[model samples]
Target: MRTDFWKKTAAFGLQDDAVNILSNAADYKSQVLEQIAKAEQRIIITALYLEDDDAGREILAALHQASLTKPNLKITILVDYHRARRGRIGESKSEGNAKLYCEYNEKYNSNVKVFGVPIKAREIFGVLHLKGLVFDDILLYTGASINDVYVQQHDRYRLDRYFVLNQKGICDSIESFMNEIMLVSAATPRIDSRPIADYSEIKLAHKQLMRTLKKTKYKEPRASNKNQLSARMFLGFGRRGNDLNKLIKNLFDQTKEELVLYTPYFNFPAPLMRSLRKLLKHGKKVTIVVGDKTANDFYISPEKPFNTIGGLPYLYETILQKFLKSHNKYLEQGLLKVYIWKDNDNSFHLKGVCSDSKRHLLSGHNLNPRAWSLDIENGILLDDPNKTLEQRIEAEKVQILKHCIQINNYDELETMSDYPAPVQKILGKIKRVKGDIILKRFI
Candidate 1:
């Protein structure tokens, strides 16, 4: 086979191929359900949160039905142990949904198993933040978790990117990694085996997890495809020790022309921020697309006074404004472009990056301090020699840009007064907020 053919095929270990980008949650749901309907042998899912909402229940129902029909099918789901047991920031605590899921697992599908990997103690400093679905040899990866808003069951929606790859080698490698870290680890305990309220048991579990992570080794198997995908997996506090940090550095150093970044928050690590600054100084084109203040948050009314829900958005705007002020020169020139998403209501939650229009990366890691220190993040990288892939990426950029308000010129940025009255009012409120928003780096 030709090198280009091998590169594209090596990622999914498949001959025929079709890559679809689901721009909206409804599209995402339709695609996912279609995939689920076709799955035969095995289905594995790992996500940050799997709520007990309409979308969540619908997915569960589908899985249950699949298991009933396919007697030989095997299904496994892994969700964050911490988030699964607790309530959302402003929501009431209820285990009713979890109980329902358990009942479904036991009564409906004996072939399907659900596991919750609690990282509270093991990830005391961060969060377990990996999201992907594997059906047979195909992998669908994105930053979205299982929830109503993320899948757009209701009117609310989350902005995200989705990639479907049929590379056998890549899929196998990732599947093996998941099995080793989450399924076969010495600390792999049943989600409902015992209550984690016991302090001594929690401590012991943490110790076991730490020990397993320290001893685990994730090696990249060698493949000989000239067009092989350039992808790497990153862990916050697991088998990989700062491997992600090194990989990121290598990617930045290899950039040639343009760099496109998508992050929900603007709080970048010192090293990454400094590296971006250096890239700008070298005259490279950098475009950052982020969720506008009101759009880039996760909060409900009952948690604060006046039932206001803009904490996350406000925090992001404040940091972004500061970063821009510090790099005014870059803004004055044509080196940097900042775009923020705006809708009548709702927040945005997506994270990924594209560099030089040749390299693309999709990950759950936000460009914030917490992602660096707290969340368990993973991504796939594609370095296409065939310019076709680059063209496709550029098209994606155009589509995303349509949903954003651009800030490429310093003069344009300074004219905040000229912005729509609502946007100006939001910015003003963020400026007056009291202390910095603080949380566990990974959560």
Candidate 2:
């Protein structure tokens, strides 16, 4: 059974000292810049979107300068094709972030190449959500993209888990996937150049790309049992037969003593939520730390103009309240603990898992329906049966919980009656017409 598990996971046999975790977002930004500045061979970045804001420009400029410093430095950036061509929600139509990419390309004389990946025809259905920034052999993995709020370039910030993995073989596999699969695909194209091809013109190639991704897998090396710290990377696409989703469910099922889940959103996929119910019935300790409604990026303050998007935070809060109400008995018995994380004006984007302090998952997967059934997601599963990462894991938990307050009472969460008038109106209309059902699958 043990040998079969190792072969199925195909995890890397890495030393305990090789994995490093950062505490804050500022350090994440500095590490990215430093890695780019010092990289020798190649730099590859994969994210959903890179905003055309101050932080995005700064990072893009760093890549440009790094390529200039080392003429042979290979650089390739991948972002969602639909996201690159369109503006943010509720904004006027414009060329979007591709404009910034084009400007930088022109300034650097086409030294940097940014490819737009058409994961789907539209932005809402699915996206290019592979997370990690590679400089040479080191990988900076986070849910954050190149944005002011994500990297803490300004006063306001978004908190997310940051991990650095130093493994050459892992880097080789990621780079090879891009070099072999993505770059050569007709659906993926350079958005940095002017007069880029339109999605309509390449509809067939786009379908072919999505079909190919659904059937493809990451290049896996030989798996061996080292009886030490190790990591396995898995790609998640559709819900059926998804090895990553199965891995996540397995972690939940295999938890004997405790399980700690970190996510910005409270919406869990139906299957995981059902598993949580069983875990509680079995008397396992489950702790969930989620962001407060105000800590949501879509939150609009009372003084700000209310838009339809502002209702997102309230919708998630409603989901949390429902979960709490259903599990109120477990809460009183101290079998389940829920913490609401809030840090002034900053937002939250953290996502990961820790099972009994032995097996840990580092991922950008939201555990929500959108991520489970639609988006392209990936995660690194670390198995440490000896509890080798106990101190470091506890430290991370303390840092994340510093600004949090436990939900001892289910009534503490706001009800729909407590929402602002505009938010109430929007949510009421959506529920009245049953649009929220559709929204849950895509958002």
- Using TM-score as the measure, the top candidate is 2
Candidate 1 wrongly placed segments (more than 4 Å): 1-18, 122-124, 192-202, 214-219, 228-240, 299-310, 408-443
**All candidates: TM-score:** 0.84, 0.97
Error of 1 at 276 (Å): 0.9
Residues 1-443, candidate 1, lDDT per residue (tens digit)?
12222133223212323454666777878877888889888788888777787898889889889988998887888877666666655567766345556766666746777776655564346566777888887778888887898888988888688777775566666677778777774344445333434334556666677556544434454655444334444444442364444445445655678778888777777767887988988988888888876675554332344233434444455567778877878877868888888665666777777766655667787866666655566666665544446555667667667778877544444334654445456555645573243431332
Q: Note the clash tally of each candidate.
A: 17, 0
- For model 2, how does the per-residue alpha-carbon lDDT over 345-398 read when each residue is reduced to its tens digit? 998899998998988888899989988978889888888889888898899899
Model 1 Cα shift for residue 268 (angstroms): 0.5
